[model samples]
Target chain A: MMQRPPTIKDLARALNISVSTVSRALRNATDINPETRQAVLKLAKEMEYEPNFIAQSLVKKQTHIIGVVVPSIDSNYFSEALSGMTDCAIEQNYHLMICQSNENEVLENKSIRKLLSCNIDGLLISVSLQTKSDNVIKEAQKKHVPVVMFDRIIPGADCTKVIVNEYEGALKAVEHLIKKGCKRIAHIGGPKDLSVSENRKKGYLDALAKHKIPVREELIAHCKSFEEDAIGAIRKVMNAKPRPDAIFFINDLSAITAIEYIRRKGLRIPEDIKIVGFNNDKVSNVVEPALTTVMQPGYEVGKLALGVLIDEIESKSTERQLFELRTTLVTRKSSR
Target chain B: MMQRPPTIKDLARALNISVSTVSRALRNATDINPETRQAVLKLAKEMEYEPNFIAQSLVKKQTHIIGVVVPSIDSNYFSEALSGMTDCAIEQNYHLMICQSNENEVLENKSIRKLLSCNIDGLLISVSLQTKSDNVIKEAQKKHVPVVMFDRIIPGADCTKVIVNEYEGALKAVEHLIKKGCKRIAHIGGPKDLSVSENRKKGYLDALAKHKIPVREELIAHCKSFEEDAIGAIRKVMNAKPRPDAIFFINDLSAITAIEYIRRKGLRIPEDIKIVGFNNDKVSNVVEPALTTVMQPGYEVGKLALGVLIDEIESKSTERQLFELRTTLVTRKSSR
Candidate 1:
């Protein structure tokens, strides 16, 4: 039979002391006698008694829980970011309640609703691909719960944001391929609606223009970030008349998918068609010939985003902070 | 200025109706006039008013939130499992709050305390390797919360479990190598503390005995299952006399690391050293010469575990249910 956990009262009774004295000892209150506190603590440890944090939180009417909503936990980028957040949370004595939206806007809103019901002090979110309106976000803000947006976000939303230099990263990626003597460089972009796609596309176009290469509208295609969806976009570029000799993908997963497909079709990487991608995902290093890519600082972004959120929660600040993190180019065998 | 969310009282004032009538109309109570109900619903929709779930939950004295704690969210195995849980949660009108322990015992306990503070309805945990006490678990049970363990578990704990036939899977992995004419088969195992490590090792030994193959002490080694840690374990087995012709790794991450290391040493896979591993991570298929592994069916395990947890939550019986999921051996280029 399972026995009930010993409460403060139980500890008090065992020591012939008052419940308030036990509580004071547990919290290391300044007024408690050192000897009495030591005895209470030793007995409490002997009885394997852990304070009821739930009961305390109920009386306080608050919790130190931060709600986080991301597109998917399986994605390497998001997972790395979450790990960074976890590290920071541990140091700051905060707890994270994470939810995955699976890249669906409806699920994202539902997750927000659930987090709100938890009375989360603050929220960290990366909007799903299909999110259009900022109303759900507005609802959370109205409750005075600060929200921090990262990566995929609603532009102009009243929240702090973790932004990356996607434009610069894309430019460097395309220029590297261009300097490799590639005349026709195609691009595989993300969902057309995403700011990431727009910025990267602009960078790609600007790089080609700087090199005096005509932008071929037929050479660019858009796809959702999933590998399977990317294959079609890749085919669109691969089959272009005067087919592109190089490609710049928005992320590593899609780039890896293209590599798998090209190899299956008996094509040689670099010598025939060079490829580059964004997000230096761990898989980028393990793939054959490795992948050349732009590295998004996902971990740092997560850490900094959480820091901004905590500041907002503790201070009565409505002024939003826009923090920008830079991405770097990593040249690997896929481009070499 | 942000406006307060329209409440039943606001709806009542706008419609010139009683607050009780408005609440009844919103909840679709049959006693309400159909026309009045339709009017209230239409106005509610127009005003962008959503029910305050947190308020409703307070009155109900419970929540539908389930707490989940995993070793790491970044691992492919755990991420896939989390995704499976997410799907079930969406279907069942439940929410999951996930915490990552980062494989630390203290963090696991801390995360549990935080989750308990949230008044979670049920808990699903895969214990960290360093966890040595059941006292914390027993405390939660004393509060009448159902806990379900999966993948990594505390043996003989008073809880439901999602068990896979890991021994059968390991037996198949080694037997396949034996059939391939590999006499010097090595095993790279996980932390000695994990039940998974124990069961898989037992199967490896049992398989070798059945095949009349000798198990050399030098050919067996242990690691913590992280890729970096597994490198030392791999080196130990690889340096054994007449170096093993085949290796059955505890998981895919370590197997992939070995593959990378072997390739760098100018060795060919299968021909030089055949390898098989557990948990066919997605990267297993992407690696050069693709790794052969035992499929752990993470998604199914997660879905089933959550189902079991929900059942235990609703049912009064404290009877523990041990549900078993099976693993399958997937042969790929690395072992072929």
Candidate 2:
């Protein structure tokens, strides 16, 4: 038979102490004697009595639950980030409440408002590609709820941000293609509004400048972050005036789309047109020739994002900080 | 400047009524007149006074949150299922609290305990591969908390379960391979601990038996629901005296693993050995030559799983339900 979890009253009665003393001890209050606190802790641990979060939240005005707002959770990058965040949140005894905006700004705002209504202590957000304003973050800041941006960081936003070194990661991907003796390299970029999109595109151009290859306007196409759109973007690049010999996609999903599109066009990967994708997702490992791409520290970014938010929530500090996580290039046959 | 949402008092003052009257009208209490309820709803809509969930949950003894416990959320199938769940939950003004068991019963128990402590209104679960007992479900049932199981349903469990027709899906896949003139067929099954795994394996054996093809002992291997294990399982099947002409994997991740291993062994897909996988995840579309897969309706399963739990929770009904969603075959190059 399953037994009921011990309550504060039960603990107090067992230890010959007042209920208030048991509660205070569980909260690690300094008024309670260290010996008494240890005794309460020992008993609570023995009974596996996790404190009632609702009652505790009523008193402390906060819970160790952070709202994670994202665009989509089905993709490898976001899920890896979530895996990292879940890993870190479990370690810190914090709960993560995830919300997806589905690339809708109104839905993003609604998720934020709902999270606020649920009394989340902080937020870790990767803004929707369609979100063009920082009004929501500013509003959240006014309410003293800390916000941390990851992956798709917004500029001039007065909040903590955790992002991969996109400019550097992109440069390395393009440089790898250049070193592979591919001229007429094309680019397939993400939504033009996102900072990662602009930064990655800039890195592509930076690589071209460094290699003395003229930047071709017709060779670049901005596409939605869906596989279907990525295919269209790749087709646009493949059909360009010069028809680029290689392509660097903004993200791995888009890169995979480009690879598939090229294959459908009766071309071969790395032979007819070499390809490099970003965010080395699991599919990157299995994609027919194995996609050579930049591996963003997605899980690490998530961990640090939650870590920083938890620190701010506990300390009630308002200092803005940015943590830039690094990325690495994983070379495979796709870029050979 | 962003203002706080209007409260009941704001509506009471505007309409020249008492706070209790405003609250009753908002809740559609019978004591309130029909005209008053309509007026209150119109004003509440205008004021955007969405009942604060945190405050309301305290009084209603309901969180409007469903606790979803899964074995692994990082996998494509689980993530897709979660995405569908979140989409539906948000539409119904309910929040989702996700917990990953990491395929450990101990971890699954811990997550369940946490969800219960949070006063989750209902549960949507897909049992872990290592879960040997139904104690967790029994405990929740005793406490009057509703649970809905999906994908890997527990056998003989007194609870509402939403699952795909695993037996039929597997039978069709194997029969398709047989029609392709494959006499030597191998089956890479999931963990024996799961009911779905057993059913799929039984279906495979039943298909071969019907085809008058004697099942070979060396041609079957259990992968235990892991990609890495499936690789080894496929190797074992490939190394058998009479190498299997076609292989049917129970899950997509495992199927991809087997395909990669086959390629590594210098064999071509369908040309050297035909392959079939389950769960038509995005990888099924992107994987080279594309995989022939069983398209289990993950979104519909999620919706129905949560739908049943919500129905039971709201009605406080005690009837156990069994819901098995159907699966369809998505033929592609891998099997053809």
The most accurate candidate by TM-score is 2
lDDT per residue for candidate 2 within A68-142, as digits (tens), equals 999998877888789888878877888888999988999999999888878788999998878889998876776
Query: In model 2, which runs have C-alpha deviations exceeding 4 angstroms?
Result: A1-22, A28-50, A190-195, A217-225, A229-245, A253-273, B1-22, B29-52, B190-197, B221-225, B228-245, B253-273
lDDT of 1 by residue, B8-58 (tens): 788899999998999899886689999999999999988766776555554
What is the alpha-carbon lDDT of model 1 when measured against the actual structure?
Answer: 0.84
Index of the highest-DockQ prediction: 2
Instruction: Provide TM-scores for the models.
Output: 0.78, 0.86
Against the true structure, candidate 2 reaches a TM-score of: 0.86
lDDT of each: 0.84, 0.83
Reference-based lDDT, residue A91, model 1? 77
In model 1, pairs of residues that clash are none
Backbone clashes (count) for model 2: 0
